[model samples]
Target: MVTATADFVVPDELLAHEPPEARGVPRDAVRMLVSTPSAQRHQLFRDLPTVLRPGDLLVVNTSATLPAAVPTLDGHVIHFSTCRADGTWLVEPRLAGRAGAPTVGPLDTAVAGQRFALRGGGSVTLLSPYSQGRLWVAALSFDDVPGYLSRHGSPIRYSYVPRSWPLSAYQTVFATEPGSAEMPSAGRPFTDRIVTRLVSAGVQVAPIVLHTGVASAEGHERPYPEWFSVPASTARAVASAQRVIAVGTTVVRALETTGGAAGSGWTDLVVTPERGVRVVDGLLTGFHEPHASHLDLLAAVAGPGLVSTSYAAALAAGYRWHEFGDVNLLLSEHDVREV
Candidate 1:
């Protein structure tokens, strides 16, 4: 089963440069595109609880977003992607902007064993290149890693974001563990009101932890191993669920890594068309970049045809894209849908 390919021209205007709040709208006010095997429709995100039926379970990622980008005095920033059990971190160095945003670049001047001072009295020593010369294995020296980072580090930003936003804007309502480098953006549309509506509608919300790595990668690059945890209770809930709806790609990857068991570990599970998902009956996720490896995971759930059609409809409807963008709910046609 080869991965399906499609061409999409995302207009520059469709890019979500800031949160919905900045645009004078609530978080749940974003649009949602619902795609099944036979049909597709557009709806508001706040209507999700009404759309899903009773006994359905929504699996969410509780891994919190980290202010991982640490700027240095030398005009460079170190992005903390993932941490190893041995206390080493997988990091990337990029050119620092005047306003604290990062422009992706190679650390051409970085050498193993070289130490550089950070802006807020910490230091990082390069150990070696990790993958394709874009990431590094570095050791950090700080009194309190979390505290120091809170004072100095900023959320990782890409060129699509016009300016820097607060770290709170990158977080979701379900975020609990502070480990992920980037937001589990699919869950961002859920608000307290949405959660209440879901519970009142008899939908169960389960949480799993997957500390995400850097998301800004070249088109062909696959995701690296990231730390994940699936508790026994969540696994049991998944087993008994009438429909298991994964809230994000991170949740799908973490649940699949469990293999019907429950524990914590690192996973490099790249969901593709050939390697279809087993534990998820559906998925609620945000719009992704074209030709990105994430599109393969979406293809696995919705199939290539539905994936392509849904994206076209979303684009035509003026939906936003990226972390702060609109959402897509891909479900099986045979499920017991309500709306």
Candidate 2:
């Protein structure tokens, strides 16, 4: 057996910062390479529905991405940026989160001890701009915090991403609730049109809420604890489905967190071979960094061979990594799912 360690090396060029310009297609359109745990093979994303027979079920996380990055008078600040079960985003930042109240000028002009009145007079004290651009965590009153932000805040955005895309672009077609730091980008390619096609073609879609904090790509600390709820109906639907096609890692995490382990609320359930997985028949996820903790989870589910083959194919084929990049897919050869 090959011992696995979270120690793989990754090339920086593999990272993606923008979505593909094409539309009316499966969000899973990014270069997809299919392989097995023991042997590598080739497959296409469009063949996804065809790969499954009648009893297979498809499970997906629908936790919508929030506009966690907000523009204050100073510039743009980010927050809750907790990563969901998937390696995608649902950025939900608090006004007083790391960045303090924004100043009236550029981030360079803002410094410690500076105070600014928020949209609702919820005053804040500037702490630091270590983030470089325009982010600072400040002290503020708790009054109407969410309300104030909803009114004055635009989604948090980073400069490197270029072209301020709307909050909608960061989500899957089945998005629900506002809990993610950013959208689970692997699901982004799943527009309404694609969902219709998949459903009509005998695919089952289910939704769950795993309020993701931020993108780990931001290079922050381990995800702050986020909440996950699996209603009885959704649980039954997933348990009964023939195949579980997870939209991204978040959905996989949420479903696995529920099966076998009987708990709810904030879960720090990081997936590895030790923990293993009980749910999710297949995965529709973005290419991830080599040796990433998220990679551990995927390898656990897809197995090293399937993961390695698929990922190897993705890399060789130039699939992008991260929320805005293309996607990768994995399916069991044995007929485990029902159509």
Candidate 3:
């Protein structure tokens, strides 16, 4: 595992608290910081058609966000993270009132075998610690999980966002398959119009499925295995494209897991400078928090020198951060040596 060391403090004011739509900004109009080893340029996300070459393939994740936060009767929120192959779930329990409060961590008192009644009719019994003591393997008593969430769950939110938003706000234009605990937010800035423009400009777009689990923002933990699938068509595109630009780190994980070949299954692959990227040529992703594991993936694709330079430029230019914030497009430079 590669440890990220992109140390830099983000001013609290730069954290986007709501979607661009709420701020009267069109999704495709959000600012994008385009960076390469040699230079950086500020542009709008809608200018993607001009940034990418005609034969370049843009890989996007189509995993839809789930309203994964379900409130319990005793005032706790259960964030259903991932469904194990055995039909159980990995969950994180947070005290309801304090859950969304900034800088507060999830409840750590949940012991194995403890049960909590859901607001509806079912109960979740904590089975064991899933990872790092932050998430638990839970046995859910409810059936038709999707229906239950549609009725009782809201989008999993944090304190940075002051109000609840509709699930639509958490989805991207490419979203179709529903399973991700949180949005693969890097794709959130895309719009149908922008996609049309990309196609008109001859840039190719392909879809992959990678259902992301709950984020490890607070803990900065390494990502766990998540389900992903690369279709035969996309794999063929990747093999032939002049460049392969992954729309999000999720796509990078999926494509790299299969080494550009078509396949599907759980992947624990973590792209780092040591394991450098093999198929992806560039990355179009949202600005991540300081020291995020996502930064390691960026370094793997573009090298640490370019990643650091790009982030410094973004911060100096007051670019926003987080899922709802602005984006960064990091292109590989053949002349720049990886650190």
Best by lDDT: 3
Per-residue lDDT over 1-339 for candidate 3, one digit per residue giving the tens place of the 0 to 100 score: 333336788898888999999999999999998888678988899888988877889999999999998888888788989877778888898867655443245888889999999987988999998776679989999867777888888898887787778999999999999999999999999989999989998899999999988888653575677989999999999999989999999999999999999999989998888999999999999888776788888999988888888888988999988889999999975442221
Q: After superposition, how far is residue 335 of candidate 1 from its true place, in Å?
A: 5.3
Cα lDDT of candidate 2 equals: 0.59
Candidate 1 — what's its lDDT? 0.85
Give lDDT tens digits, candidate 2, residues 55-145: 5556666777665555434433435244334333222223332343322223355666676544444455665443444344455544443
lDDT of each: 0.85, 0.59, 0.87
- Considering summed lDDT, which 10 consecutive residues are worst modelled in model 1? 1-10
Question: On lDDT, who's better, 2 or 3?
Answer: 3
Candidates ranked, most accurate by TM-score first: 3, 1, 2
RMSD of 2: 6.6
Better of 1 and 2 by TM-score: 1
lDDT of 3 at 248: 94
lDDT of 3: 0.87
Alpha carbon lDDT at 220, candidate 1: 71
Cand. 3 TM to true fold: 0.94
Residues 276-300 of candidate 1: C-alpha lDDT, one tens digit per residue: 8888889999988877788888888
